[model samples]
Target: MVPYIRAQNVNLTFRPKNRDPVTALQGLSLEVGRGEFLSLVGPSGCGKSTFLNVLLGLLRPDQGEIHLDGKKISGPGYERAMVFQEFGLLPWRTVLANVELGMELKGVPASIRRERASELINLVGLTGFEHHYPHELSGGMKQRVGLARALATDPEVLLMDEPFAALDAQTRDLMQAELLQIWDRTKKTVIFVTHSIEEAAYLSDRVVVVTSRPGRAKKLIDIKLPRPRDYEMRLTPEFNDIKATIWNSLKDELISRGIGDGR
Candidate 1:
């Protein structure tokens, strides 16, 4: 059977004026099952975000192809929605308006959009804050808004580029747990790009590690931990074992690039 999402032998290169071409992805491939939460973890320049862009149809790969449910991804479509690291909210818009933005753009009826946005706002734990503006909220709250906006359209797949990276440690932890609850409830296929090994282990069904620049898939590690996970799970031997496996796969790329001594 065909996979829900498939990226085969993908490659991309960037050409800047008066500079040598840089390849971001080469021979990188992956398949994500429907409703699966997948994470990509690699060194800083390893094209994790680049791959996410490809999935979002933001950047066309120079070679190879990516498909969703057997359809080639040629450009942006409502079937996919992205949550950027930066909260890409309109500063002047209220949380409810921001969440409704995508559905509004898609020509969803005003009444329906407003109703859907309200439900999503509550889902993300921002029920009362729907009237609040971006500046009025904390980093975590803003991210919740972004997440709600991404989901308002009811996209089949969600692409997240280090969505929690900017939050403080405690908030990040809280958001991680919140995200799992949301995912369990929504069941949208997710492709998340994060540099944190622990974060990847905690959030994904399978974590894909890519090699350094001109990135390619290096290894895929499956998380065997049972779900309905809580913070206490992070302290379990199983979780740490998963972390160690991801670290082992990632450290080789870092050491090869001289970023670490592999200690």
Candidate 2:
């Protein structure tokens, strides 16, 4: 069977006027199985988020192609949605209204969208805060609203670009566990871009480490850790081993780019 998502020899370049062109991705290829949670990690500016935008159809590749299921992706479709690191909630809208935004744009009726939004609001653990606006909520709560909004459209694939990176350490960890729970229940095919090696190890079924600049897949490591994961699991030797493996791969990329010492 064909992979649920495939990127073959994908390349993209940024050609800002009067400046030298920067290649974001070069010959980056990978295949994701249906309902798989895949994370991309590498040195900063390695095009992980750029690749996510490509998958979202926000940017067209200069070469190669990406296919969803058996269809080639030419532009953004309702089948995919993204959650950003900065909570992309509208300050003017309440939690419920924001969650309803996607479905609303898709022409879903108020009654139906309201019901679905309510359910998702609850799913993201923001049930009673429906009336609250973005300003009234904490960083984590705003992210929950963003997550709920992303799911409001019922997309088959979810693209997350460091959705919890802004939160405090404790909140980030809590959100990670919450996100896994949501993923378990929804089973959405997720392509997450995160710089945290531990976060990638904890959340992904497979972690893809890319090379720096003109990013390409450097290593694809499978995490064999059991699911229904908890903080206690982080203390296990297996978890640390996985983190170490990913770090070593990413470390090599950084060292190659003169970003850090191997030590």
Candidate 2 RMSD computed on C-alpha atoms after optimal superposition onto the true structure: 1.2
Off by over 4 Å in 1: 261-263
Indicate which candidate wins on lDDT.
2
The TM-score values for the models, in the order shown, are 0.97, 0.98
Instruction: Give candidate 2 regions above 4 Å deviation.
Output: 261-263
lDDT of 2 by residue, 1-263 (tens): 89999999999999999999999999999999999999999888989999999999999999999999989999989999999889889999999999999999999999999999999999999889999999999999999999999999999999999998899999999999999999999999999999899999999999999999999998999999989899999999989899999998888789878987643
Model 2 TM-score (2 dp): 0.98
- RMSD (Cα, Å) for all candidates, in order, is 1.2, 1.2
* Residue pairs in clash, model 2: none
